[model samples]
Structures are given as structure tokens and as C-alpha cells.
Target: MMKKRTILRFFILATLLLCSSSAWAQGHSYLKTAAGKSLQAELEFHRDPHQTFAVRGDNLVLAGDLPVNVNYDFDYSVLEGQTLTVDGEQQHGGRNLVSIVTSPGEVRVESGTMTINKVTKEGEKAFLEGTYELTLEEGKTLSGEFKLHTQFRDYNLSSLGWVFMLASIAGVWLLAIFCYKKLLFDAE
Candidate 1:
């Protein structure tokens, strides 16, 4: 009886471990450079509620570190299948922006289309598959596919709201300590 129970426990533990590993797996993404070199990276979509005055709506941001010390940021409107131009000249604050920074040089997107193939929702998170074909400033083409995981965020608190909440908690804590001290003094 004891041996059977131990075997059952080990089987259950191994099954749980296998299931958890699959749940935490990251999606795959890659971009081929102008020189025919492919850069692989994991990209995830995060809904950013904080946008500047110029930007119209919330942006679906894809920012991640690439191979060979490269970092890329791609921001697009939440709506799928909407084609927009990549602003290479302007580095920051624009709709449908694509910027890539490398160790030695920076590669900006001159023109191209980023197509969203499909989006699959699993519970609160979603998986996005897309492809991008970009013409670089160096007159080279960069294209690849991306499978990104979605990150859900709550908009209940802004930056100011967070600060105010902390301040209120501190104030209440201080008030409680002060009252406790006064009560002790009066009793003495």
C-alpha cells in the first residue's frame, strides 16, 4: 500500500511540472536584417494606457531585446489589420512606429507594412501572430514573422493616483501611531 501511494504521488508531481512548463513558455519572434542575418527575439504585447497628447489612443507596444545587443520597439494601434507607415525620420512619439537600435548602428524603418495574421485569446491573455516587411534606410529589406504573447494591465491607477494612495496610507498610519501614543500618555 505504501509503495503504491508513493508512485501515485510521483506521477502527479511530474504531470504538474510538465503542465506548468508549457504554460510559462515564451512566444518566438525574429527579424532578418539587411545583410541576410536573422535576429531572434521574444516579443510580448503590452497595452499602454499612457500616451502623449499627439498619440490618439492606447498603443499596443512590442519592445524587447534582440540578439547581438539590439533592442527594438514597435508601437501600433490596438485595432488589428490597420496598415500604417513606419516613421523612420521621427524617432519618438508617433503612430505605428518601428525603431531598432544596435550596438554600432541604428536601423530605422523607411517603409513597409506590418500585417497581423491572427490573434488568439486564452483567458485574459492573447497570442498575436504578425509579419513585418520593412525597407530600411540603408536601402535594404528586413522582414520576418512574430508570435507575441499579450500582457493585460489594469487602468485603475494613474501615476498621480498611485502617489496619492501611498500618501494617504502613510497619513493614516502616522495618525494611528500618534493616537496610540496619546492614549498611553493619558493612561499613565
Candidate 2:
């Protein structure tokens, strides 16, 4: 009877530990860049899970994959004296290229073109397309992009989920051990 009680106690503790650990081990975000043409570029702001910013001559492209709504703003000093264009429309801004787009879309500028697209279950990528012509200037230009992506899964338990799991398992285990000891060992 005593042996049975001890085994029940061990079972309860192990169950609680397992539940807590498994719950805490979920959900993470990361960034990834792919194989592509190298262009002179700088990142002024990064506000998403994965992002890329590139500049070719007078054209610029910014892309990313994200799980939530994020806003990023950037300035380009490289396009000092060039005219800006997007989707074939001329932009009057002194800086060559300025653009904004949601993820899985496109932002085309005089310096280049940028396309944001979904990459995987948990990732995304951006692409550059079109031509660029550079002039001369000093003050610089600004461009930005925004994205929102949300994913949900059942097994992807959050911190609260783990806590609940642990509490339930511990409670069950304690009750089982108490019952076994009272009815079997203490009764004997």
C-alpha cells in the first residue's frame, strides 16, 4: 500500500513537470535572406520578423515576412539629384525613390523595384525588379513599408497554456496520490 502511494506521488510530479516544460517551448520568430543579386543598400529600420532592403542605382526595394502589423520608415541619401518613379508614375520628391507597401505586394521606385512575398509557413521574402538611374543631390529621400501576417495553430501553446496544463496535471496527480494513500495505506 505504501509503495502504491509513492508511485502515485512520483507520477503526479513527473506529469506536472512535463506539462510545464512543453508549454514553455513554443512560438519564436526569425529572419532569413535568400540568394540574390547584391546591391548597395542600408537598413534604416527593421520592424518585422524577416526583412531585406536593397538599392540599385536610383531604384530601391524593401521586403519582409511578418506575423503582425509593423511599420518601418527609412531615408535614402543615395538618390540626391535623381527623379523618383513608382509603377510608371513620376514622384516629385527630391530623393530618387520613395515607396510603401504591405507584405506579399510590390513597391517600385526609380532606384529599383521591391516585391514582398510569402516564403514559408513561418517566413517571407522580398524581390527587386526594374531599372535605376542615378543623379546627384544632398538632402536624401525616404521610403517605407508595412505588413501584417497572422498564423494560428493548436499545438502552438503559449505561456499561459503551459501554466494551465501544469496546474491541471498537478491537481490531478495530487488528488490521485491522496486517495491512494487514504484508502489503501492509511486504511491498512
Candidate 3:
């Protein structure tokens, strides 16, 4: 019975860990435009995960929806210097779609860790510093290398829910103890 209960407790804990909403969170992306413009988009809307702007790979699909409602999807690659096909359409001809130059290292953005890559200057390549505060074209200031995001990557758990979960565990343990005593020792 002890072994059974230990297994049961493990299962219950696993279930709670898996089904919890705080495990996953909404991510956001911050970008600076060529015109020195500042743009922010939600990962939920931009279709990125863990606030990952984009991964460097072949035929990578990248989209930046900003300025309200102008949806643009493009196929791009970071490892290879290829023309970024805008709108994912072959006919448009990706000549000057978007360019980026990233340094070799990891940068902390907001509460989560994000890759601080440069949104390359037209006709020229530029380097991005991870510890610098960036100002946008619209006069919006990004706080340190974190110009990309402004939040931490911690669990979004509610204090009330956490308390309730703890209480439930204690209650279950107490009930189990009472049941064990009544059945094993109090059986007269």
C-alpha cells in the first residue's frame, strides 16, 4: 500500500505539472526598422515559439506583422546568403527583402534569453551589442540589450492557485492518513 500510494503521488504530481498553464507562456518580439522605427509583435500573433524571433536555417519561414494588419510572410535562410522570397511567392523575386547580422553569443532579453541579432542596414552590414540601450525611430527606448523584450521568463502562476494546489495536497495526505489509521490500526 505504501508503494502504491507513492506511485499514486508521483502520478498526481506529474499530472499537475503537465496540465498547468504556467508551463507555457505567450512570447513577444521586438524589432527595429531601417527607418529607426521600433516594432513589437506577439509570438501568439507572429507564430513564433518561446519568443524566438527566428532560427537560422534553410528555407526558414519568417513573418513580421506590424504597422497594423499588413501580413507578410517570407522564406529566408540565415546560414546561407540567399535572397529572401517575400510573401512566399516566387514571382515577387526577393531582391531586398530583409537582412540581419548577428554576433556570436547569447543575449538576455527581458526575463527570457533571446538571440540579439542585428537588423542589418541596407547595402551594409552592422553589428549588434547585447549590453546597449537602443532607441527606436518613434523615440521608444528599449532597456539594455533587452531592447528586444521587457519581461522575464518565469512561470506565470497565480498566487491563489498555487496556494490552493498546496492545500489540496495537504488535504489529500491527511485523508489518506485517516483512512490508513482506521483500516489498519483501529480495526477492532
Candidate 4:
């Protein structure tokens, strides 16, 4: 009995460790500032989980508010399998435009490259993993890595459609109740 109990405890501990590690790998970012300060935080989709990420035009936007507020946008890029080099200009063209906001302040990626290392796609969901090394103003450098998940569509219903569906369900329930009452009266 004691041996069985020990094995059970070992399995429980192993399960907990596996679950925690997977949860931690979901989405995370490690950013270094110009002044040598480092900020590490989780990048989560704050809006609805259904709307994990978005691709507006040629821009890939990941906005979240957690341990730190971050708005990481890679302009002129969509999906994975590409490396975007920052030309130091903020103009939206073939050049990759990007921005990183940390706790200290906003740091513009002046010169460097952000490489999307891997992209895992399962159905409509996609996981993006990448690393970036950029030069900030005054010869300061910043580099980090990021892994995030995004969905293709939210799949939300419109207000009018919801109203129509609810009305139809209510009408059917009312009809059923009325028919039951009429049947009882006829039996009487």
C-alpha cells in the first residue's frame, strides 16, 4: 500500500510540472532596454480569447496589458516564415516597420532584424516564435525573444442574429406549452 501511494504521488507531481511548463510556454516576451534594464512579461490577448490576434493589411499586431503594456506591431509582414529588417525609417513601405514599448519608455527598432523562427499552425490557430536584435538611439542596443499565439477568426455572432435565434427558441417553447395545456383541457 505504501509503495502504491508513493507512485501515485510521483505521478501527481510530474503532471503538475508538465502542466505548469506548458502554460508558461504559451506566450512570453523578454525585452532589454537601452540602459541595460530588462523587462520580462507574458504577452496575452486581452480582448476576447476568440480574437487572439489580428492581421490588418500587412501588419501583424499583438496588443496586451499585463505585467507591462505592450503593443508589438510588425508592419509589412503577415504569418510566419520571414525576417524583417528595420531600415530606421517609420514609413510604411517594403521596409519592415516595428515598435516595442517597455516599462521605461518606447523604444524604436532603429536597425536590426526580427526573424520569425517557427510558425506552428493547427486549424485556424497559429503559434509564432521569433527573436529580435535591434539598435536603439545613441548607439544603444536591445534584443529579445517572443512566442505568441493567434487565431484567424473570432467567430462571433451579430446582435441581430442572436435576437432572432432567441425569439425563435422562445416562440417554440411557448407553442409547446400552449399545446400541452390544450391537450389537458380536451382530455378533461
Which is the better candidate, 2 or 4, if ranked by lDDT?
Answer: 4
Clashing pairs in 4: none
- The candidate maximizing lDDT is 4
lDDT of each: 0.49, 0.36, 0.34, 0.50
Per-residue alpha-carbon lDDT of candidate 3 for residues 1-188, written as tens digits (9 for 90 to 100)? 99999999999998987766333321123334344543332221232311123212121222222222212232111312221111211111222123222221222122212333433321222222233233322344333231222222234566987999999999999999999999999998
| Model 4, CA-based lDDT | 0.50
Give me the candidate number with maximum TM-score: 1
Q: In candidate 2, which residue ranges exceed 4 Å CA deviation?
A: 1-149, 152-157
Off by over 4 Å in 4: 1-78, 85-98, 103-106, 122-125, 156-188
Return whichever of 1 and 2 wins on TM-score: 1
TM of each candidate vs. truth: 0.47, 0.22, 0.25, 0.39
Deviation from native of the Cα of residue 95 in model 1, angstroms: 14
Cand. 1 Cα-lDDT: 0.49
Q: How accurate is candidate 2 locally (lDDT)?
A: 0.36
Report the lDDT of model 4 for residue 8. Answer: 100
Model 4 per-residue lDDT tens digits across residues 112-169: 6656677665565556677767677667776666555554444467698899999999
